[model samples]
Target: MFDWTRSCAYDEQQKRRFHTTARSRLKKLAAELALPPGSYDVRSNKAGVAVSGEVTLHHTAVYIQVGQFGMSSGHGILIRTCKGRKNYTGGANHFVALSMLDDIPALAAAVRAITGVGRADADSADRRAA
Candidate 1:
């Protein structure tokens, strides 16, 4: 037999803990990236943690949203990107959380991919030569 009320309370507690840990990690990541001040925003609450920022990719501006919610291994990241459309262009679905310090490199790479930071420069140069 299981108690639904108790389960719900436990779930809420887990969410709170996850949100706190994720928010702390998000702030650390922002500082580690060292982007221009006020370039990106970090938001956290009982719900979850989110990092939204703008980056110029190949002469175009893009918005990137990354965050985490819940506390299951099933819990993962949500990355949403948009250019100028009402809907996102291409983004990730719920896969798995990658917030561990050991996973920072992968997280950073994902950020670069979405922002097209360093990679965009190389890509633009190749296109100009072609």
Candidate 2:
């Protein structure tokens, strides 16, 4: 005898909890990154929050979006970036889509590099060059 209804309820509850946790962590990370407060817009969706912000790196402006989703007791983050446009760019116009969770730190590092921060002591010259 299987209880499908009970299983679905449990799954939903777990998803809600995961979403909450993920949203909190994202806000914390944004603060740690020194990104201007309120510079990013966070909107709640069925899965999680949609975070959008403009990060300037290497003198180029980039539009960033992160869609977070909950799965079981864990969460997933979807990172996307778009080149700045003088006018509105339609959806799905991202220059990059980073789907792996493990790649998040690397992606963050890239952003930092672009923003002229987080360079190695030896690489200060490179940053200055940029």
Candidate 3:
């Protein structure tokens, strides 16, 4: 004797668990991408902490900024190719909520395109483009 209602409940629980696990994994990946294997500087600002680093994408050097919010619980990262851009001034233009870690790769690719750093790795960029 199979109970349809009970099966539906089980499916809902499984979906919830899968979502939770996926979110956690995405956050971990975001942290890893936030810091590459290189030297970076951390500076404090009134709003949050800013991380300045250099990233080489497609053999082009670009300046990166990863900002961690101090006043708020959430954090953000901004990667740019140009230095002293008014858009990123005070960390306004190139901002992505840390809570949306799952979409970080897409965001990064978009930034790279805007900064004219050449397209990112085909496979990696494909996922976001799709």
The models' CA-based lDDT, in order, is 0.42, 0.37, 0.38
Cα shift from native, residue 113, model 1 (Å): 2.2
lDDT of 3 at 24: 47
Candidate 2 structure quality by residue, lDDT tens digits, 3-91: 11122233556445444543554554454445564455444444322321122121113334333223332323433343333323423
Q: What lDDT score is found at residue 16 in candidate 3?
A: 41
TM-score, structure 3 vs. true? 0.34
Q: For candidate 3, give the lDDT of residue 119.
A: 44
Deviating ranges (above 4 Å) for candidate 1: 1-9, 45-75, 83-96, 99-102, 118-130
Error of 1 at 8 (Å): 8.6
Worst 10 residues of 1 by lDDT: 51-60
Mind giving the per-residue lDDT tens digits that candidate 1 earns over 1-130?
2111111233665445444555556565554444445555555434322211112111122333333323345234554444443444554432334433335546546656655532323554598799
Candidate 2 regions exceeding 4 Å error are 1-10, 47-75, 83-107, 110-130
lDDT of 3 at 54: 16
